[model samples]
Target: MQWEIVVGLETHTQLTTESKIFSGASTAFGAEPNAQACAVDLALPGVLPVMNKAAVQRAIQFGLAVGAKVAEHSVFARKNYFYPDLPKGYQISQFEIPVVQGGTVSFLLGDQMKTVRLVRAHLEEDAGKSLHEDFAGQSGIDLNRAGTPLLEIVTEPDMRSAEEAVAYAKTLHTLVTWLGICDGNMQEGSFRCDANVSVRPKGESKLGTRCEIKNLNSFKFLQAAILYEAQRQIEIIEDGGVIKQETRLYDPDRNETRSMRSKEDSEDYRYFPDPDLPPLMISPEWVEQVRSEMPELPGQKQARYTGDLGLSEYDAVTLTASRAMTDYFESALAVAGADKAKPLANWLLGEFSASLNRDDKTPAESPIAPELMAALVKRVVDGTLNNKTAKVVFAALWEGKYSDVDACVKGEGLEQISDSGAVEKMIDDVLAAHPGPVAEYKAGKEASFNFLVGQIMRAARGKANPAQVNEILKAKLS
Candidate 1:
């Protein structure tokens, strides 16, 4: 009785506009509760909603980035519901027709390329927050987030595992943030994910009863919740129990899900087009304007990196994982020349990444400037400094003790002993001083060669290029 897991994700990304989607109220996060909610956001009497042009433009930009079709015409509908935080008693959202449609999100899972087909993306207004903390036996409503513009992107049930689903979510996060539409900040509720998960017998054509896991804010949590929910459903089916289609919440402390309520279908909302808002229309000229302003997206950059620059697929994908990181790599390459791509990527993805994580920093907050990294990479390639000496140079750059790589090398006295004649003299000195090891090497004890090389480096005070030292040692030993 082998079972397979199926998953689909619906992500709500808060747009980067300065105001709410249907009102001019400020969208700045962390304001006092209910203070920022204007008459329109508050749904006061005699107030009418007006759509934000900037939010729409951002949605268009996303559609273009993901290769989705931007709908020329769409409609806003009122989703009838009862909730304490929903001031309007109904949410304004796109129902029958959405702004964007039919796109695929591709990302790497390990070395394999995985793609998730998107159903559609629609523009919607976010509901306010219901606060339970800091109140004694009573609840509070924070209307500050009311009317905030969100782009709800839905996907088909094309994912087969938790890893694939998590990968899809991460891929979408990268695309949205790269497009500059959303901040992609899970901590601030700017980006949230809901997963619909089910389990069915292997090779079965019929889908199993599905449950929706609500509002997983972090990637780790998203993966954990899906795995837990899938197991829960599989266990129930194996135990001769029925799986109910309900909404569940992941309890991070317990690492399980608890049923919140039954899942509702689209008809349950009783959706109808709003009379106050006309049919939303988009112009080709506007779409073209957005397309023109778009920067090279991640996929485009990945292709160019691999095809034009001759980088490996893995290196290209790692380099283009984020827009800021790609910008950093390009800026470094600009200073160091494009030929340095492989080594530059290695440093960026290896030591540089480790340093960033150690310091709990991002590429934007990195102390090492792009130009400085380029200079460091150039020095390493040219034998001006080896990896060890370059690390000392990086420390200086990180501390701002030196403004240039050359200055850092000079300040720390890390200049490589690359002079051929000088290296030859040091190797000769080592061979003469270490006669026993030199004899061992000449007698076919190949392991003694490394000892001779180490002796030469020590004679040169660790400044000699090991490659040059090895060459000079080999010549002397012969």
Candidate 2:
């Protein structure tokens, strides 16, 4: 029997508030083990936790950005659990009432637009890390991540495939980072995906037993882990075995998930409202204030780029993929002018993006300024540098070999031969070398003219203007 995959995701986004949720400890990454954990984070006796205003504001900003309702009154609860990394023996989270509710995350899967409905996005404090590698059979607890603020965005089991799950996860990642609520860095553990995957017979009303794949930090792993887990369930069911509801870990190197423990239900955690913290209250004015300060979201920017700026759908999607990429595109567009937006986008996504990835650099760390990139695109707009020569100039500037495109072009003598007389001579030289193509063109073979142009460009060392070469070659053959 054929089986269908069912998937859902719980994405934990670490907010970028300068401090932890209920404490004054620094939320910065890469700190010494446990140094950033304060007495409040460690759950010291006689210490009461206080909510951070900035963290709530960040959550409010996310709700507004997604067109979700921000809860006026939300409560924090203690999630009782025993783990090495959890110092408080219970996590502070939102259970009965969450801060943000009823949002949709949409993404393009091929030609179709798919949306994943969010169950709720709740505010919570993160658990610390359990380091087992350096302890030599013993484990160490690092409380640096403890008390860190996280907006746990949970989605309904609306996803039908692993690809759709990944797309939804990526869209959520982009949205959180674009809103500036979270940094969305997977490497430093700022963003994570907990995927619930299962397989059931097609057309079944009831859902199959799912296993949670925990802590998928990268998209590649997120997809692979879900697919592997789904297949594992299908194989077990087909073999007359049972699919258990458990939590699993994605071993990226092995490209599979192994059972970590049985999945817990709400009652397992023994969740209760925290007595130390009062019921959280948010006012309409606070939501309005955050909405006022919000930037244009990815969907809005994409629409503007495609509808207002006349960019292609693909180009618009690419340009507005992230806040940083959108800023970079517009920064260069500002310097280059609106008329050059198309080429500017093409270069940004094509050669410019390739250069950055090839050299392992980010848009922020790029040595070439936006103005310099604008200059490079402007050169392509004019006849000074053709497309091929522009790439050469970009390569040089990317390598720090030249300070500017003009310098690179002049240094490499790659100036396009736009002069009619100079281009005519090059075409004449090509005609003299190849008599067969000239005769074929004279006999009304129209395609041979392209060959003659290529010969002309080759002779001119890719410096011949393509339009000029086409015009010059036609004239020479005529």
Candidate 3:
């Protein structure tokens, strides 16, 4: 029997504000434990919580970016929970009234564009980290992250496959980062997701018992965890065993999920409006101001890249995936011109991405300047260096030492060998060595022609102009 997977995601994105949500403490990561924590963050008695204006502004910015309803009045509620990491014993979050509601994020699943509906995005305070190391028997609690501002974005169960869920998550991550509402740093726990997954018979209307996978920080893991869990649930139900609704943790090393605990329902939290803080009232003027300042989102940027820049749909989507990459691409294109767009796209997505992967750095941390990349593209276009030689120059540029493309080309002696005499001599040597192949080519064998081309390229050590070599070889053979 065919099974259908139903998936929903609750993503927690830390706001990019400089200060904590309810305290004057710094929200910086990697600080000394408890150094950034203030009295309010410690949840000390007599310390009242004050909302950060910047956090509210960022939430509004997100609402504007996604075309969601920005509520003029929103309230914070106390989510009662007990853990070593939660200092206040109850987290201040939104329950019934959230800041943003009813937005949709559209993304591509291959050639099809699918829209995932966002139920709501609410403001809340982050819990602290529990350290399991450096203690023989007891764990340590670091309150540094406590009371940090977070935007919990909950999406409707619109995805069917794990790939779809991951694609949707990545799209939302890019959107939040591009809108400057969040940093979207998955490694530092700045951005995280909890996926609720279930499996039912293909035509079954009622949902199956679902499991929630917690703290998935990467896209690959998110896909794998959901897939593993869905298969496991399907197997259990097929074997005549009922599926249990529980919380699971993804063990990436094992490529499986383990049950953590039974999933808690909403009523278990006993959510009540926080008495310490009043309802947040944002004026329409504030929302409009943020809306006017909202940058071009990924969807709009993708359309512009394809329509205005004349890039392929694939290239446009890839280039507009991140705001930093898009900015770098445009800056380089402006200097390189429209004629160099396809080549620039290839180099950025190919060589540039390879370097980024090798160095484990993001586009924001790219060492090569856009102007320098443009210069390299210009060198290739103007024939100062061939495509093969430009790769070497690109490596130098990526190391941040090469200031001039001309100087690098000259220093590396990578000038294209366009001399007809030199190319003809090399082609003559190849023809003399491979008479049978030359005869085969003369007899209309296409493979022999490619073989001869490879020999010519090897003879020139990738320095010869390929088109010119092909022309000269054909003329000499004729």
Best by lDDT: 1
lDDT of 1 by residue, 194-261 (tens): 99999999999788889999999999999999999999998898899999999999999999999999
Cα deviation at 21, candidate 3, in Å, is 1.1
Ranking 2 against 3 by TM-score, winner: 2
- Regions of model 3 farther than 4 Å from truth: 399-401, 419-435, 475-478
RMSD in Å for model 2: 1.9
Model 1 ranges off by over 4 Å: 432-448
Number of clashing residue pairs in every model? 0, 0, 0
Residues 1-478 of candidate 3: C-alpha lDDT, one tens digit per residue: 9999999999999999999999899998999999999999888889999999999999998888777899999999999989988988999999999999888888888988899999999999999999989899889999999999999999988899999999899888988888887899999999999999999899998888889999999998999999999999988988999988899999999999999999999899999999999999999999988888878778887888788778888898888888889999989999999789988998999999899889998787888888888989888877767778889889877786678888888887888998888888999999999999999989999899989999999988888887788899888888
TM per model? 0.95, 0.95, 0.92
- Which is better, 1 or 3, measured by lDDT? 1
Q: Point out where model 2 deviates above 4 Å.
A: 441-447, 475-478
Task: Supply the global lDDT for candidate 1.
Answer: 0.91
Q: Given candidate 3, what's the lDDT at residue 216?
A: 98
Please give the lDDT score at residue 116 for candidate 3. 90
lDDT of each: 0.91, 0.89, 0.90
